[model samples]
Target: MKLYDYPPAPNPRRVRIFLAEKGIEVPTEAVDLRQGAQLSEAFRRINPQCVVPYLVLDDGTGISESIAICRYFEALQPDPPLFGKTPLEQALVEMWSRRAEFEGLLAVADALRNSAPAFKNRALPGHDDYEQIPALVERGQRRTKRFFDVLEERLAHSTFLAGDFFSVADITAFVTVDFAGWIKLTLPETHINARRWYETVRARPSASA
Candidate 1:
C-alpha cells in the first residue's frame, strides 16, 4: 500500500497519526498542495478529486478521504481499536467524530480558507476553484469559538471526546484543535479541561506524527 500525502495539511495529518498509532508504516509520496501539485494531470489520474492523503491498496484500488483510509486500516489492524471496540462504542465514536469534523474542523477550515490571502480564489478544496465569501469567514470564526466552548464543557466531564478511552473522536478533535492555530483560534486560558486534554494528547508519540 502507498499513501499520497502532504505534510502540514490537517486532513493528511489525521491519517498519518492514525497509521502511527497502529504502528503501520507504508510508503508515502508527498503531494505539494501549496504548489498545486495535486491539480496536475499525473495526480488527477490517481485521484480525480485532486486531494491529498489518498491511499492505494496492494490490489491497486485507490481510496480518497482521510476518514475512509483510516477505517480501512482499522479493519486491517484491530488491536489498537482506534474506531471503537464494541457496537455501542463504535456508534458513540462515529457520533463524536462527525461532530468534531463538522462543528470543529470545518469551522476552522472555513475561516482559514475564506480569510487567508493565500487561498483567495481557492476557498474550497478540490480541482475547481471557488471565491472566498467574506460573510462565511465571519460566520466561521464565530462557529469555531462556539466549538471550542463545547469541547471545553465536554472535556470537563469526559476524559476523551467520545468516552474514557481515546478513539478516532479524540484524534479528529486533536487535529482540528491544532489546525485552529492557523486561524489564530485556540482554547481559551480559562478552558482548563480542554487545555489539559490537549496537552496530554499532544504528548503522545502518535501526536508527533
Candidate 2:
C-alpha cells in the first residue's frame, strides 16, 4: 500500500496522524500541492478528484477522502480503535467528526481560501480552479468564531470530542483548530476547556506527524 501525501495540509495531516496512532508505516509519496502536482494527468488517473492524502491499496484500489482512508486503516488494525468500538460509539464519533469537518474545518478553509492572496484562483480544492468569493470570507470568519464557542461548550463536559475515548472526532477537531491558525483565527482565551483539550492533543506524538 502507498499513501500519497502533502505535508502541513490539514486533511493530509489527519491521515498521517492516524497512521502514527495505529503504529502503521506504509510507503508514502509526497504530492506537492503548492506546485499543482495533484493536477497532473498521472495523479488525476489515480484520483479523479485530484486530492492529496490519496491512498492506494496493495491491489491498486485508490481511496481519496482523508476520513475514508483512515477508516480503511482502522479496519486493518482494530486494537487501538480511533473510530469507535461499539455501534453507539461509532455513531457518536461520526456525528462529531462531521461537525468538526463542516463547522470547524470548512469554515477555516473558506476564510483562508477566499481571503488569502496565496489561494487566488484556487478557492476550492481539486483539479478545477475556482475564484475566491469575498462574501464567503466574512461568513467563514463568523462561523469560525461560533465554532470555538460550540467546542468550548462541548469540551467542557466531555473529555474528548465524541466522549471519554479519543476518537476520530478529536482528530478532526484538533486538525481544524490548528489549521485555523493559518487564517489568524484562534480559540478565545476564555475557552478554557477547549484550550486544555487542545493542549493535551497537541502533546501527543502523532500530532508531530
Candidate 3:
C-alpha cells in the first residue's frame, strides 16, 4: 500500500494520525498541494480526481476521500481498533463522523474557498475553478458558530463524539475544529468541553504526527 500525503493539510493529517495510532507504516510520497502538484498531469494520472490524502491499496484500489482512506486502513488493521468494536458502535461512530465532516470541516472549507484571495475562483476542490463569493464566507462563519454550539452540546454529554470511547468521530471533530482558524474562528472559553477534548486528543502521540 502507498499513501500520498501533504503534511499541513488536515485531511492527510487524519490518515497520518490514524496510521500512527495503529502503528502501521507504509511507503509514502508527499504531494505538494500548495504548489498545485495535485493538479499536475502526473498526479492526476495516479488519481484522476487529483487530491492529496489518497491511498493506493495493495490490491490496486485507490481511495481519495479521507474518511474512505481511514476506513480502508481500519479494515486492514483491526486490532487496537479506531472505528468501533461492535455493529452498533460502528454505526454511531460513522453517524457522528459524517455529521462532523459535513457540519464542521465543510463549513471551514466553504469559508476558505470563498473568502481567501489565494483560493479565488476556486470554491470547490478537485481542480474546479469557480468565482469567489464573499457572501458564502459570511454564511460559513455563521454556520460555524451554530456548529460549535451543537458540538459543544453533544461533547458535553460524552467523553468522545459518539460515546465513551475514542472513535473516528473524535478524529473528524478534532481535525475540523483545529482548522477553524482558516475561517478566522476561535474556540471560545465558554466551550469548555470542546477545549478539554482538544487538549486531551492533542496530547495523544498519534495526534502529534
Candidate 4:
C-alpha cells in the first residue's frame, strides 16, 4: 500500500498514528499540500478529488479520506484492536469516531479555513475556492468551544472517548485538540478529564508519528 502524506496536517497524522499503533508501515509518497502539489494532474490521477492522505492498497484499490484509510488499516491489522474486540465495542468506537470527525475535525477545519490568511478563498478541503468570512471564523470559535464542552463531559466519565480502551476516536480527538492552537482554539483548563486524557495520549508511541 502507498499512502499520500503531509507532515503537518492533522488528518494525515491520524492515519500515521493508526498505522504506527497497528505496527503497519506501508510505503509512502509525501504530498506537499503546502506547495499545492495535491492539485497537480499526476496526483489527481491517484485521487480524482486531489486530497492529501490517499491510500493505494496492494490490489490497486485507491482509498481517499482519512477514516476510510484508517478502517483499511484496522481490517489489515486487527491485533491490539483500536476499533474494538466485540460487536458492541465496535459500534461504540464507530459512534465516537463519527462524532469526533464532525464535531472535532470539522470545527478545526472551519476555524482554519475561515480565519487563516493563507486560506483566503478556500473554505472546503477540495479545490473549490470561496471567499473567507470573518463571521465564519467567529462561528468556528463558538463551535470549537461547544466541541470542547461535549468532549469534557464525555471524558469526565470514560477513560477514552469511546470506552475504556483507546480507539480511533481517541486518535481523532487527540490530533484535532493538539492542533487547536492553529485555529486560536484550545481545550479549557477546567476540563480536567479532557486534560488527563490528553496527557496519556501524548505518551503513546504512535503519537510521535
Q: Give candidate 4's TM-score.
A: 0.95
Model 4: how far residue 123 lies from native, Å: 0.9
- The segments of candidate 3 whose C-alpha lies over 4 angstroms from its true place after superposition are none
The best candidate by TM-score is 1
Question: In candidate 1, what are the lDDT values of residues 70-128, reduced to their tens digit?
Answer: 99999989969998888998998999999999999999999999988889899999989
* Candidate 4 lDDT trough over 10 residues, lowest sum: 120-129
Say which prediction, candidate 2 or candidate 3, comes out ahead on lDDT.
Answer: 2
Residue pairs with backbone overlap in model 4: none
C-alpha lDDT score of every prediction, in listed order: 0.93, 0.92, 0.85, 0.87
Cα error, candidate 3, residue 7 (Å) = 0.7
User: Could you list the CA RMSD of all candidates, in the order they appear?
Assistant: 0.8, 1.0, 1.3, 1.3
Query: Candidate 2 versus the native: TM-score?
Result: 0.97
For model 4, what is the C-alpha lDDT against the true structure? 0.87
Clashing residue pair totals per candidate (backbone < 3 A): 0, 0, 0, 0
Residue 46 local lDDT, model 2: 89
* Tens-digit lDDT track of model 2 for 118-162: 789999998789999999999998999999999999999999998
lDDT of 3 by residue, 1-209 (tens): 89999998889888888888889887889999888898898998899887888989789889889888888878877977888888988888989988888888888888888977777666877866678888888888888888888788988998988888888788878888888877778778999998888898989998877
Clashing pairs in 1: none
> Which portions of model 2 miss their true places by more than 4 Å?
none
Clashing residue pairs in candidate 2, if any?
Answer: none
TM per candidate: 0.98, 0.97, 0.95, 0.95
| Candidate 3 lDDT score at position 80 | 78
lDDT (10s digit) by residue, model 4, range 1-209: 78999979999999999999989888888999887788888887788887878988779898888989988777877887999888999999999998988888887788888877777777777766678777877777788889899899999999998899999999999998977778777788999999999999999999999
